[model samples]
Target: MTEQIAHEPLDVLRLRARRRQAGRRSFRQALMRAATGIIGEIKIASPSRGRLIDNARPPASIARAFEAAGIDAISVVTEEDFFHGNLALLSKIRRDTRLPVLRKDFLTTPYEIVQSAAHGADAVLLITAGLADDQLQPLLSEALEYDLDVVLEIHDEQELVRALTFDPSIVGVNNRNLRTFEVSLNVSKRLINRIPRHILAISESGLRSPTDVIAMKQAGARACLIGEALLGADDPRAFIAACRPAFVA
Candidate 1:
């Protein structure tokens, strides 16, 4: 029998785990909350379990559909292993759409922030599960200097407190737990009340239908980051358009 091989480094895994302890706030939390539109998250991950259709749509094609649906932002996953995303793809998507682009990656160091800005990204995703609060603040300030938005992603209440320390303009409650990789819509509902009305509150992960989007919005999510469901659809634009009537015009 062949032995399983490790793909990610132990140090990288350690760095990601350490982020839960260093709580901080971010400036972008407010903008995300104030946003009146959806934030379309793009990913070209290895196919999901039991996937029947092999014809996953190209990133650009999907991005165009997102733009047509009037999304507030576009987040391109740059991680390669699980998501099969690339930084170069982000640059490509940026050239194709007027919407603000967010580089979604497990960003650990300052160099990565510079790389994101240089790559033509308008924003960067800093997960609360990936960086210490102290480590996150400086990076937040630096990204701001470049005029890039910073969206902080947190998994739970502890992470939320840490996220708040940075005073984020947008704070996303990712329903997917990094450790367990489980998702629940209630995650957004549970965290919404704790966040001030001034900050933009967003729900990330596991949002599937129009009903799901509405539920999230009612739970105080200014916007919802949707990807898998849209990308999996036969016509992403049509599906997204169908959901538009529910949001305030």
Candidate 2:
């Protein structure tokens, strides 16, 4: 199924996507209500670290655990080659959980956005590093057309500058450099405040503990996307609860 979708014509993919319902769970509103939102990820593998989890454990089962743990949203790595994920995983996770599911992939085309919607994604990650200047806005616009929230992901000052031009609703500052695949929390710290207060900022990568999440929140990030750490934890639900910020009464 995944291989077939990858080879399908753009028009055919669009038609399939359009046939499915568009209005999905809101990824934006989920973060807006939290003091510090936690987006638990269902990542099976990665290029930098190799396979992270036993793929034998169903993705939906993990998603259900996240929902039970009070996760604000879910991120599913759907990039086939390096991540060992596909849209089918996204679909299964979406069906099994109420949390808005994000499609985390190196998407470079409008067709992929439509495919995301067809597969039941509530949002899609658009990496600034992967997109050309002209390519960014159009791809963003395509996601918007399907009512899929866009996580405009950036890694540096230049990408941040380009992302701001679009006035993205949600900006994700990825700590891992796409080129080097090296992770750091300083990347989020350096850029979080630079993002306007009105736009939701999500700190991604290199976050392993509640203390790390607190630091990002203190630095002005409203949410943290934790994948590798959560998947590797002895108790993911307990880890998520600990990572959540204290709520003000």
Candidate 3:
């Protein structure tokens, strides 16, 4: 799949992406209406924790479970090398669920943005730490052209500054440090408030338990992206319900 992505002509990919005429799902609206927006992630493995779920459970089944659990949206890790995910899974999951699906990958090019739209992604994650200053705005623009929402991900104050320059509609504060692979909710706590209230703030990574979710909410996060905990849970629906704000009922 990596080889295909690398060798395919940009024109060909663009043509395919533009041909997709599926009705758009509004990721931004999903977060805006939810009492406590929860984006359940479909991931098979991670570099830090290794394999997260059995291959027997398909990605579409996971999407179904997330939808049933009342998650606001879905995030599918599409990077094949470290995350053991592929674009095919994104398309399959999108077909099976009503929630908006965000393609979570280290996307840096216009072609990747187009490919995501072609593969059924309602949104795309662009990390501030990974993109150069010149690359960030253009990539955000490309996603917008495809009618795909952007999740500008940042890990610190510096990246937060860089991300805000693009005036993104959504900002995702990732708690996991890219340098050491360490996880801390403090990262989210520190950065969330810095983002403007008009832009939706989403806390991502290392979140476990309702206490963690509440902490992020209190810290000013309107939403969160949760993966490992949900995948490892004996009852994902119950776990998700538990993670909701007390007022949600």
Candidate 4:
């Protein structure tokens, strides 16, 4: 017989736990007040390395490079299962820099939101694909109470519609399809017209060069969430800085 697997109600458990821990903190308001531009993302290698393993860069070095390059924000992956990230690494990055740190995780409940905010994250990623309509308000509410900026991410049309339901301040269009793992820049461009102009629009995934930034800006994106390209570079910061329009000019 095939081995059976046991699963816990992680979402339910986390939601209950977060509700009990709720207290005023202020990440959302600060994020809204801040500028959304050129968010440099830091990704750790998974324990099971992929084809990009040869280019792994330490988080410290990565953070320093991005800072020197003048990035507006920094995102640290805290997912351990697939991204090979650690919460400890995020804490270290947070303490080391003044730039707003975004906790780039699969945030599912208020508990995870509180944990991120309390740990010094200025922002948190909320994927529309992972949440339902009824579940979003509670999570967003708790995150707001903790003063965390929410980067609501969507992968497609349906998720985009769901994301708009919250009137999010910051919206990220992820090019990577969560199911097939395929990436296409068109994802963000396709959804751009539908997004409200007042909201800070971010393009994520498949962004490779400064040209990509130009294209995205022209397509109406205010910012881009880049991970693989920077992580794959020998000089990550320089690569990101080079992508800046001012630097290029």
Candidate 5:
């Protein structure tokens, strides 16, 4: 499969965002309401772990289940290389559910940013691993101008420093070490508080239970972006329920 490029002009995307942008689900509002929000992810496979629920359930079915579980938001992995995901899946899930759909991909180019919005994403994930210093600001600026939320995903302190410069509305600390693909829940704990109080902090990957969720909250993360464990669970809701923090009046 040929990798897609940004053929659509930025102006065209801005016009379309105005004319056809779907009503926002207010993911930022959702985060403000909980101690530890769960952004349930829709993924078929991953680089470290392959083929999660390949033939077991379709994207729409899993989405319905997440809705039934009352997921705070939904992340649709759209990269095709190792993840077996497509932009079409994002559109399908977005149309079927009111949950804010995040286009979780290795998006570095402006074309991919516009394509993510055009394909029905309410938010887009931007990882700091491979992005050039020059490529960073334009992508961030365009995504915001296009009316899409940007989740600044960082794996370490260096990336965290760069992410803060952009002043992202949301920041994600990925527990998985991209080079080794090893997951450590501590990555979120170590990095969350360094982020300013104004930003919504998210911990991604390596979370498996309610205890893990509680720990993340204790460390100051407002949300957790989970994928594999939920997809592999016999009941994904149980996974979600186990992760939700006990809120008190």
Candidate 6:
């Protein structure tokens, strides 16, 4: 899988995991109290679930609906092989949507980051498990230099520690395990407590209902990158509305 690769040695993962834990008061407060943002996503397919749309609407149209739903951000998956997503979709979404657009893909190189910027991405997804610290450091630095926000994704305690080495302000705890392609809310519930303050926390994948969305927030996620469930819904607008009630005053 593109999500699983060894750029950093195994010892690095072990060593980083050994670093100081982040269960401080300030950290816990940041996770629990921050106002949550909604990050709706666009993708026509998935490697694990097959096709998402029978006749996919144009990226611009999808972005328009999501914007109308009052989502805080837009995530456009651009992985061509598995998701059938493309850079053109991202560029088109950027042009159509007033919201910030995040380029979600299996980014492994600095080149992909550059492409994300050139294509009108306001941010990019970087999975810690996909690249080593040696590669992650330079690529992350380059993304910032390009003025693109980085959504650093991690799955477990080890990956979370490894991700912290870069001092990212935005973190994504994916509920779906990339290696096994299994979905579970426990992943985020278990890992969210470890993430500290001043950083925006996002829970990604397998969020299927309003209750699921609320649960993620209570577990310390400040946002969610929702795609599949939203795409498969009978009423995308209604579903989006439901996911946000817990966050509303």
Measured with C-alpha atoms, the lDDT of residue 114 in candidate 4 is 65
Q: What is the per-residue lDDT of model 3 for residues 149-248, given as tens digits with 9 covering 90 to 100?
A: 9999999999999888888899999999999988999999898989999999999999887778888888989998888888887888888788776325
Over 96-136, each residue of candidate 4 has an lDDT whose tens digit, in order, gives 87677889988776667766765667788988888888888
Q: Which digits, one per residue and each the tens of the lDDT, describe model 2 over residues 1-249?
A: 466656876677677667665557899999889654989999888877888878587778878977887789999999888889988899999888888999998898777888898788999999998889798878888888888999999999999999999989999999998888888999998999999999999999999888898888888888999888887778877887776653221
TM-score of each: 0.81, 0.92, 0.94, 0.81, 0.91, 0.83
* Winner on TM-score (1 vs 2): 2
Instruction: Report how far residue 191 has shifted in candidate 1, in Å.
Output: 0.2
- Which candidate number would show the highest lDDT if scored against the true structure? 3
Better of 5 and 6 by TM-score: 5
Q: 97 in model 1: Cα distance from truth in Å? A: 1.1
Residue runs of model 5 more than 4 Å from their true location after superposition: 1-15, 246-249
Off by over 4 Å in 1: 1-36, 46-56
Residue 172's lDDT within candidate 5 is 86
User: Model 2: residues >4 Å from true position, as ranges?
Assistant: 1-12, 246-249
- What overall lDDT goes with each candidate model? 0.73, 0.86, 0.87, 0.73, 0.81, 0.76
lDDT for 117 (candidate 4): 62
lDDT ranking, high to low: 3, 2, 5, 6, 1, 4
Pairs of colliding residues, candidate 3: none
lDDT, candidate 6, equals 0.76
Model 6 misplacement above 4 A: 1-36
* Model 5 steric clash pairs: none
